[model samples]
Target: MAMKMSLKLNSLQSIWYCVFVVVTHAYLIISAFYHYHRVRQMDWPDGTLPKPELGLYMLCVTAALLITVLFIPTQIFQVGNNANDRTKLGVEKGDQGPPKWKGGLKAKLVFVRRYTKHLGPVGATMHIVSAFCLLLPVMFLQAREIEHGLLPPQSIWRSEVSLVPVIEMDRAPSPPPLIDTDLMSTNQPDLKPHVKEPPYKVSMVTINYINYVTALVVYAILYGDVFWFCHKGFALLLSVQLMFNAIQYSLGFIGVSLLYKLHTYGWDKYGIPEPAVVSSAAGLVGLFLTNNITIFLSAVVMFLYGYTRMKESELRKRKNNVEDGKCSVVYKGNALRCQGYIPHMGALCVLVIFIICKSPLIVEYLRAFRHQGDPRLLACMLYDIFYIFFWAFLWVVFALKREWNFNFAYLDEVQSVKEESSQSAGSTGSLVNDNGMKNNIELSFVNRYNQDIHQRHNTDKVTEVKMSPKLHVANNMPVITQASEKYSPKRLRNGSATAEECQLLHQKQEHEPIQNGVLNTSMNGRPV
Candidate 1:
């Protein structure tokens, strides 16, 4: 049956555009967490706990300053005063709005509570961003038609427009297996050659504009009296993308070592069957060789090598921990789930196999729907759909992380549960007595349960110890805990401090572990 579908911008492709976003926005997310964990471990002039919420605030503030004020056009063209108006109602005392936003307008003005604890609305904001990204392109197109007198621009206010992609996807059957098919001519008719689809940059531009708008909207929400998330989530994403690009570009130029390259090539070329690397071409690739055994072989070698390297790195880290009794350095986690990671990689792998095997299924789909059935024949298009979903999913994850980075309403008083009962053998004193002075050194190190990075422990729980020497009175005595496992900082609340203190504390958090601290910091950085 013949079928026709119009191609449009801003549908599935919008998903693709958001992929790179995974790299940048995730950075800020990790940064928020870093600050959270950092603040938890630190100690200030008073015997108060550090609030991760400050890092969250810094991030939200940054997002607001950069995106809302800078990237977006100042004049908001959208209709209405804003659908998310919750502050008009007179807020009474005792009711912590949404259990996250900790203060009223007056308290917020005076740097009332430790970081803005209202994290609930951020999820809604993320949903809005995703929906906006999907729908804006369609609106822009309608806007275009209005400009050309084909459609009215005011139609947006009405129900005349919808945000669905125009492309029609016809699911096609899988191609006959290469081994099962006959090499010689059979009863089946020869198929027509396939051509590249026409470019859709117009829609792309529209998508770009919408993305800019959505980003700006998110930026503006960072400091709202109620709930907002942007800061570290956005920052981490940017940083991750930058680092990945740098590494990829570097790898592209140097072309992995010569011996390494030769060893992989040798096995792939002639079933030498030696321990080899993974196909160097396995990850994100540049040039590809399809319908050929050579590239496929290369992939196997590259895979082996990659696997070996990963194993070696893990072993090295293990050895260090065993000998030095010091924990290994842990890199930040990626914002997106790994499901996207392997699937995207799979698409590339499948691409290589198709090149070598020249799967007949691809040929039939092209013949059946080159005009209307191309979606069926094109595995790449399917890959395109998956990639889009991956990006959007990552955006949601990044938004959640952004919230985690900032919400500090609960930091007022964080009590440690240890009570000097469960201290390890190598544990130091809970209370240090000095000459004539009473030192009430409390082991505020709270109990931490987390997964073990090493393969030694199969279970996903570990205890954490907090030893802040900064609050120690005696110069000779120091707060120390056995370095058996990595320390997970315990956060108390989000707070504020002087800019000088912030920078110094921020630096210390990055390098040395936190000692002690507290301040009621606002999302809009202040001395509280």
Candidate 2:
């Protein structure tokens, strides 16, 4: 079997890469937080500054990205470069394997052992920290929404706002002479009504909250193995989570980008609230856009971990005679059915949902809101087009090529059962005793029968047996004649013995003289 090799970062490389990721993410996190604070501080008198909790939510996701990034290196370090190398080296070197250190003060306590059994103390800590980091933004949003009701819906289209400014000469006040410059010109009609809030604030918040809750639940299962305890099962869950998170954020990113353009155009064209409003809002929007890039990069790291875990799981299952699509495996004492196409099908479902939710947003943004030849129009069109295409193509291709039916072989447990049955049969059917002495099966059976006969008979009866010099096989059957108690010759045929015959022979024992037949006896006084 070919060993699957995984690319591993050396210690120095991991350190350097981690340092770079940390430093860059640190800067971005600070920038995002600053922009979030700016948005929170914005003076919107009517509470129309879009989502109030977006800043805090972004901070939560950013923190999770950081921890997940740092966790990448630690997890990578735990994995060996070559799958088989560690096990082979372990056996050859008589190594006791990696040391299991009591993770922390809390993990060392007896009460904590149950929770930490599967993950171990250190792993449980990491999961708890990461899960909380991911959950923080969700709880915050839910609480904030409950405290302050959801924002009101905004217009999908402008009802009375003029597309072009109109100058009314009849209504304009007569200006003073040009020489009296103090009151120079008459006031002009407004170009368009100021758009105080985004058109999709309510929808955006609703979708964002949904995605947040879904992501939190998904990550909980993916990390803590809440639903599926098997490594491969959780790995599949993680992959699905990452894919869904990426797609959800991709949809959000496109929407945010369009909003940025729409807001910038409105601000520039109509001068709605002046550049002061633009600065804070633009900073927040820009922070969201950039933060998505960080998320994508972080997801790539997690995706690698998930992929590695899956491949290792497949390898392990194969070692235990469990193959994908052909057999299931015993995981956590339960049969877990697995196939290569299941996750792909899950990804496909996610893609379909993404299309359903995001397609209209993209169409509306491009066709209705964006002007012809807008700089961002082409880029957004290309991005969403290829984004959907990439996932659709990848998952569809994978799902179609792999088998859908599960064999339900349960190979692991089946193999174990076969081994146990073989062991029992060998132990019971063996011709050797427990003390390593060899004994003939037939001789032992006959000796047991003779002992029963001797116990049943108390009279002293002389029994004589003649030993034949050489026994010849006649018609492939060995026949021995023994004398009965009435001197009647009884024939003993080989390979034709049964429990009933043995019982009958014991019940009516007749050891008479050997008249015309000879019996060959061994030193134990039993016929061989």
Candidate 3:
């Protein structure tokens, strides 16, 4: 059999990957539910809730349920079966044989495998549609907030006095009425009225829901697969989204900071007094930070996917010599030399940074307990706490414990098969051709049969050829001999060939001579 590189997922790694996927999906679903409940309980001042946000959250819940139903169980069952098969075989036997499934399990496996082929198309469509649905609504909401004075307007002069006409009053010839009492009142018109239109209501529920759904769909379509273009597409989408969010929030953060500074130090100079500026700054910062965390995590995930794909490609290109049917070089004694630890560590660092970024929200949540505050702030704090711990546990189990690594099959691991004519002359000793030429013939074969060993190798059949006691040649026919043995390639233990074995094979190859003026030869003991 021609050798080709292939992914060699072990039972443990497969199980860990399954667990990670299931837990991550569960977290997303719970988050969606929390968002839905939070948004539903919110009441706008005009008594109209954000219906678009509610619908998007509901769609996210539906998508989560569909993913759980369609993907999670199949992955669990597959991993479970794999673990069971490995356990039954024991470490000594190893994973050389094809997995055997019986009864209902086999049927279930077949059904899931067949149905998941369509998930790619379905998932891709869902991801693109959901992104637009969530983004457009959020954009509209932001514009609406600015228009209604719930959020800070673009410019105080334009928003407050753009329509007012400037008038100059000549000094009154007559003495001012009410004398000094009216002079005490300054010319500061009440700016509070202009700034107090309505409370800002920015619901992240819809955006969060959409992001969760998109992530889930993309993962379902790409997880545990080795399609290069699919991985690249996923990475590109994540990068684009991350850059967009980063730019948007950075601008928002900078603008809010400038407004807060202006309100603090130069408000009187600008002749503007809006008490809500502090709250506006806090709200905008919190909102932007929350979104930044979400987008950063998504980017981290996509980066990991791309990194894994690159590792796979590198493994395929690796060239190593084979000694006794095993690759001479084994990476850290692991069959699967996958790349995982670096990405896992990177994820942990990102999670820690996320926790740090949410500190302001945590403080706000604490203050909210003492005074009136946005419930969304409290909700975000709680979610951040949960998010941090959930990922911490995931890192401990999958990354820290190093369960993410797997074995890959390299080309050198493949065993070559020798094919020779099975037909035999009467005997193997002396043969006489019809032209009266005499030739000496010899055949030697070894037979080693072990059923457990045979099953372990998963070879279809093992043939052993032996030398006949006598030989007779006629009609100028040549006597051909083929060697076979019960040794199966699958069960061939991974190790370097001993000095004696290497020397014997080298000497045999070097000293062997062609016969009958025919240049018959074998490369690596396989007839050419």
Candidate 4:
């Protein structure tokens, strides 16, 4: 038989997924600083300096850092509350809570040890990755300062010495040819300095200094949140962080365009060194591409989380009002109908924006590749190529297979299984009926609704009823009174249900209630 599958990611899978994101982001950070430093070193022929425009790049890493920071707390909460002793250290739900400020050093250390023992791998990985992220900017700043020189050039003008033969003096007859070497030295022409190239003011050093410092401060604050194990606090912080990330990634395309324009300017006007252009472009592409993917994944995770929570909340609400079964059905249908698909829609929008921002960069880089083939460009292209597969995997594995309170299945697989079963049954006539009864089935909304209405209105005092599919419905209405007493839950449990009765049971399980009095059901019959 074809088995039902759910694509929801468990904790382990989610952690690994986030690890992929974190690794990519870390590379992006390293690449950004490396190339930014390289670009800063180039003294353009036109005296113009290239701008790395690290404002967005800084935020990009900051977003990644904050997300990692948030993840630590989430993990802490999950672990502390976990009942699985094998997965947790000594920490449990009521293990005297986290260390307080008034606690002694030993107490604090003991408290830290409990959580850290369980979270060591995850925390250590984050710290290692984030340390590079935090320190690279400062290194870039220092390198930029030392490279462009401790002080701006005193004079913008550069003078060149040229030796020109004193033809007029040579033509003039000398009084006498001195036998001494001093006479020959006297003929040496005086050197004259001519101003050839002038330097233009480059403010990139100051601009980057400010940018990197601000980024460092912002990143440090987020980093501090890592040790703070308050989920509620992180939730609030994440809202702001997410908003900032959204704005940055949304305008990331503009940053790319600007960087491209700067590179074009240098290449066209001054014939800037090719390596400089390539490095700058590579960094720009990698930064934005990776950053966009990171943010997109983050958005997907957030939406999926919210979607799961909404489902749980609804289920809780339904269970709490079990006595009002009809209200529960109506409430669930209306609520889900209105809001169930928001997460999918939101994720799709993020994906679309990600594509829009990254597509132009890919095309631009392709053109760059034609000009000069570099490993950096190849790396970017690889990211783009793999990103396509990643999107497919996410959609197919996470979105489509999700339990949306609607039947979603691999139709071909189901059909193949059904055909195989039928062929086997045909070869064994004695077991054919039993095989058919065991086959999975589904009920249509119309038939299910008829059955529900019939149950409510009929005077039958039966605790439960099961009937053969052939006798259950006629003319779109439930023929409940006609059902025989041969089928029951006990009989089905004992493996004695006939094919018709088993099919009816399967149909009953798949039945989804229609929204009554809220939505018009007149097309089916009349609103309940």
Best by lDDT: 4
Model 4 local distance difference test score: 0.39
Q: What is the C-alpha lDDT of each candidate?
A: 0.29, 0.37, 0.37, 0.39
The residue-level lDDT of candidate 3 at 508 comes to 39
Mark the 10 consecutive residues where model 1 has the least summed lDDT: 469-478
What TM value does model 2 have? 0.33
Error of 4 at 326 (Å): 13
Residue runs of model 4 more than 4 Å from their true location after superposition: 1-129, 135-139, 142-306, 309-339, 367-372, 396-528
Candidate 1 has an lDDT of 0.29
lDDT computed for candidate 2? 0.37
What is the full ranking by TM-score, best candidate first?
2, 3, 4, 1
In terms of lDDT, the poorest run of 10 residues in model 4 is 426-435
178-274 in candidate 2: lDDT tens per residue? 5645565665555444434333322123333333344334333333232132344444544565555445454454445434444433444433332
The TM-scores of all predictions, comma-separated, are 0.20, 0.33, 0.32, 0.31
Candidate 4, residues 1-528, lDDT tens digits: the string is: 343444432256335534654565556556656765565666544543424534544754675567565555433334331211123211112122344545777666666655454322343334434543443343333323333453232111111111122322223343544465574465643344444444333222232223323333333333323323323343344344444443443234333433343353344432324444345645765656676566635533443443353344434433332212221112222234433556566556666766665666666555545554533444455566555456545555555544423111222232233334333221000101121133322222234354444222212223334423222222233222222445543232211233445345335423333312112122244443
Over 4 Å off, model 3:
1-341, 365-377, 403-528
In TM-score terms, candidate 3 sits at 0.32
Candidates 2 and 3, the one with greater TM-score:
2
